[model samples]
Target chain A: MSDTGLNPDMVSSGGASAAPPLSRIQGVDKVFSNGTVALKNLNLDIGRHEFLSLLGPSGCGKSTALRLLAGLGEPSRGEIRWEGGAPATGSATDKGHRDIGFVFQEPTLMPWATVFGNVYLPLKLSGVSKAESVIPVGEALEMVGLTGFEKAYPRELSGGMKMRVSIARALVTRPKLLLMDEPFAALDEITRFKLNNDLLELWRQQNWTVVFVTHSVFESVYLSNRIVVMAARPGRVYEELEVDAPYPRGEDFRTSADYASHCRRASDALHGAINA
Target chain B: MTMSRPDDDEFIPLPGLTPAQKRERIARLVLPGLILGFAVLAWEIGVTVNEVPHYILPAPSLIAETLIKDWGTLYGSLLVTLQITFSALIVATLGGAGLAILFTQSKWVEISFFPFAVILQVTPVIAIAPLILIYVDTVQVALLICAWIVAFFPILSNTTLGLNSADHNLRNLFELYGATRWQTLLHLRLPAAMPYFLGGLKIAGGLSLIGAIVAEFAAGSAGSGSGLAYRILESGYRLNIPRMFAALFMISITGILIFMSFSLLNHVLLRRWHESAIKREN
Candidate 1:
């Protein structure tokens, strides 16, 4: 039930060469129907158990890339394959979908549903009975520190609490892969920083691969072991920088000189991406 | 830094109204009652002062006396109207909701039949009542049909709008999870459309009574087996003006009661989660 033991020392050593790719976007070209080239020749590899951040500006197709990875979208002209074969995507029963836990830019909780119902959704969709899913849903809620708030509606929760419910819903299925798209772009600085720490702690504890898409250089550098800076027009990877900082990253790391330097580098790459 | 624990300062009581809420509740009932009381008192005084003729406009006291004296006959008519109103309302709700669900299933069906529904809605029930009366075996069935036609459109349109108004992000989430059409409609669409459905039901409740009355009026002079509309007509012909006023009073009371019942249903269903139902300090 735990993925923590699968790849414990997954800290990247400034190289994508050591670990086998959990998935690959091989020469992916996504041309939207309206003649927008959202992504072109976007070749990237997802390192197993790696904390990867897709850093880009608004038009950089970072979210598009994450969507493709989550099997919520498809490349117009290239292959997205899993480790052994093509992404085994079908319905909720598919291997590709079951392996992923997606956190959207907005906390897309059902307004009428309770926290428990929202967290129980993925399992319920996969035909797991409510009775069978009770424990996992409870554990997921507890993991997000929302254990007592299970019966609360989304409207009752503040923005951050709603996001936590979204996270709990994502985590309930115990997915191997977690994909997020600007999940914290809407929060205030204090709440964002707090969530950043809580998220990193959860990531460290769970040991699942995370593909976080963000516009914030500071956020990418703080969370990702390797940040893939992307360019805008015909969105493509401009460069990749490994943070090389050790795990158990905390508030101390947030204020450290190395963290600021990494943020500077990531921001510079992002600006170059926006211009190019 | 803070989570919205149930024990937060929001101070929602476990199962009953809080003190402030109870006071607001009292104000809700008392304010409406005060307005009605003031208006009725003014009417009674105004009539007594002007020495208004009983036939033109009966005083409140006179109407009340007539109401008690004629209770046996008027109550029967009121029951008849209530039965038709409720039966029509139920049919409209079921038919409208069922059709809306079908529309969600396929755009073609909606495209094919929506215009016809619009036609039914736009055409006045009085204009259609004659045709309905000719086709149906009984006047009651014709009255019910007329009422259903008037009440059906709001529920259909509101429910359809609500279903279509589902958040794009949530729809994408459902698609991402591979929810089937049935599951999505049943779980997501139905709950999303509830507030809209209830809003429409409130409107339809009043409109159904109006439709029944109009249909009865159109039935005119001959259709006299049951209903307040007929009593009004019969009293008018007999020149029993007080009795006519009594029948009208019962009709008004019934309409208000129907409106209140459905409004209460809406409040109860949406109180916990809906923005409209949530009580704010302001």
Candidate 2:
């Protein structure tokens, strides 16, 4: 758990209770069809109930790593070993792994569906009827502070509200791991801050593992208990920083000297990774 | 701009139409009617003042009189033409959409059959109608085939494009959730394709009517169960120029009605979500 640990795949100190890692990416390499080396020898351990941010620049394969965790794509070289012997590699013939929820940078809602319908999608894919999903869907929306917007179409809502719906959809299934790829990057600063606070609050309450990919130092510092800075040109981990500050982090903590010091460290690591 | 209180978020009612919007709404209805009224009046005046013989160029009044005077025969023929048009449209919808789904399911199938669809689309229905009439046993079935041939291509092409156009992120989301292929098709692809399919339907509706009339002209089967086009042909032969104008008028009205009805259907289906159908604040 020490910062000076030599293993790049070491689990963060946030899960200090000695629970085994939820998943492990062991020597994963991703080479696209055009021979673009997206990831090179990537190794990381996702601790249970920990907010781990994969902070890096564009082309750093942070998103590629997230997608692999969600089984959206296969690693070209190595395997992701999940808990209890489940592997995260996708196969078209098998019923896909449903233990992961994902949020894209864009809201990515079904434009033709109502808010409830969009949020109910994961359960529906699992064969839960609409009549059966009302309570869980309502609860998910309420968790995101969007209860009254269940009937509104995505077009009628503001961008912030649409992203809220996207979050609600991701949370509805109550998945074990939530993978978010810069979900607030497209939003305004005020909205981004508000959502960041709400997301941290939700993560604390739900106790689900989250792997958030972002290029923003402040955002990574504010939300995550641990940050992994990754370098591009065949993306690999450069460094990991543990944000030792306590949680239930609020506006006061945001303005505190403690938060500034953590951001500065994360920013320095990020800059080093970018240069490397 | 007015500052809205945070508590008033639940029911931020849409503002009432401004004066300019009201004027625009009124002008939409009134302007078209006024121009049409003036044009008809001028035609009436020009015909009656010049004492032009009815055979050469029937006046508006004569055309209207002929419409009522021969409603029994004309109405029956109108029904016949409408039956062909609607029937062709329904069959075209089923066949075109079904084929498009099949095309999407397999690349090899699409590659094998798509060129035939393009060939059918590129060859003029008018040129093919005579050959179809020569082969098919019944003129009515031949007309239906021509109309269907004209209508189905747009639906197939548009629906294929729409199915392929589902958001890439959404598709990945569905895949992550372990959605079955059938579930993805039913929930995502079909609904996403609705607006495009409806656009194709609007175009097909009018084309079906045109195809029916053109096929009837080629058939020239004038004894009984003839459509409005046959009446048009018969009136022309007898020099009943006013009746010919009357029949032509019915065809125009029918075309307008088909286009308008399909357009209404499109708006109703997509008013809530689609950019083409939603009403923007500005």
Candidate 3:
């Protein structure tokens, strides 16, 4: 893998290590100037190829956590470390030097750009020559099942197609860590289910770490290897659940008895957090 | 509940055409065309029946005859008016886009300069035309400057709004990709601003013609070269009403020409990309 330089296996496995932790959040606190606490004393360790989700209700700061990780906002106190180092400072270019992909609740595809052009954006920013970028862009578009939509502008696409374009855009960079903030919340149920399954397939194939933020308990249960349930009003983690389901989880798994068990547990945890 | 088979596989054809659709298509053409034809007929009849004299109100046929007779002179003046309008439009587009970029970059500059732009938009160009003629030294330069001032503000205002109106979610998506400010402006803001800028261009196109005529009126009276406005003024003073009507008809035709040119440009630029450009097939 091109990312072997930052191999997570080297750090934890007692092997000769070239690099360190892929991402580390320690003692992070976020308080606005207006004195509203968003995240409190947060600590998280995300290794390469892990699928972790921050599951919470509205105002629980799941999106805020994602923003902090993306370096869109700074932690009020403490630090976010990428590759076992402090967040980069100075110019926005310098800040968060690590390659990070983000998808918002909305598709956020550029209305002016065709699907291919939108996918080509990060590559263009990295100064990848157009010829060099074509294959990777094509592969990413194919991965998202948007193969023939290369020339279709965002306005011409339906909501699902737009979101697929957004996903393709994020994947074009092949970033080590993908941060998605409630990306499927706006989708209809069937589209949401299809996207969820497609996303997991992509995750398994790429083996990239994903930090997904979502308000849906079923979503977090379905897609995450681990779910971190957050409480509202000063957003703190209320519970952590490790989903023991095997890899390459299929649509069949969604209807299995185990899926219901996980959902029930998550719902209980959420209720407990709200009450507490 | 069983998951409804994804509508993804369904290809719903466009709705069937009905009597209503036919009626709508016919009405769209007939309503505007009929109203125009009726108005022209009334004007022709009123002038002939009331014996309003050709000088007072030349019939449409006489106007057409005058147009045919004076086609060469009128055509020359029309080209001059077009030159002023198009030149002013180009200058306004470049100037407006440049200032909008600057304003987007700095809040202080926007706050300071925006009010001055508003003042220019509201202030009468006729009031300033003589002053511009006196200071500009050349008649063409004076006319260009006057038209530019009149046409510049809409583009600036519309473009700035469009640039700033990028969706917050899209802005975040760009930031997440670590796009530089310049990259964001070029790839995101500028493309997003196209519709608004083009809208402003349409409005400015008409204003440019009006401004050129107004400026020429003030300039010709101040002893500048003879433009269409001067011909109209001179013909009216000499009680040459047919010639004055002819000049008025030429000016209206000039306005229509300016409008058609811009409408064409809008269609060409936006046809494949925008709903506003799409003509209904039905």
Candidate of highest lDDT:
2
Stretches off by above 4 angstroms in model 3 are A1-21, A33-35, A84-98, B1-31, B275-282
Docking class of 1: acceptable
The candidate that achieves the highest DockQ relative to the unseen native structure: 2
Worst 10 residues of 3 chain B by lDDT: B1-10
lDDT of 3 by residue, A1-276 (tens): 111122211212211224455777777789988999998877666766778888877888788889999888789987877774543321432312336788888888776677788898877765567788788888878887877667877766678777888888887777677899999888889888888888887888777889999889899989987777778787777777767788778778899999999899888887776775
- Write the candidate numbers in order of decreasing lDDT: 2, 1, 3
The residue-by-residue lDDT of candidate 1 on B182-246, one tens digit each, is 77887788899999999989999999999989998888866755799999999998888989999
- Candidate 1 lDDT over A157-232, as tens digits, reads 8788888889888887777888998998898787788788888888888888999999889999999988887787
lDDT digits (tens) for residues A131-157 of candidate 2: 888988888888888877788888877
Once superposed on the true structure, which residue ranges of model 2 sit more than 4 Å away at CA? Answer: A1-17, A87-98, B1-22, B221-225
Candidate 2's fnat? 0.38
Ranked candidates (TM-score, high to low): 2, 1, 3
> Relative to the true structure, how large is the alpha-carbon lDDT of every model?
0.82, 0.86, 0.78
Docking quality level of the chain pair in candidate 2: acceptable
Which numbered prediction scores highest in TM-score against the true structure? 2
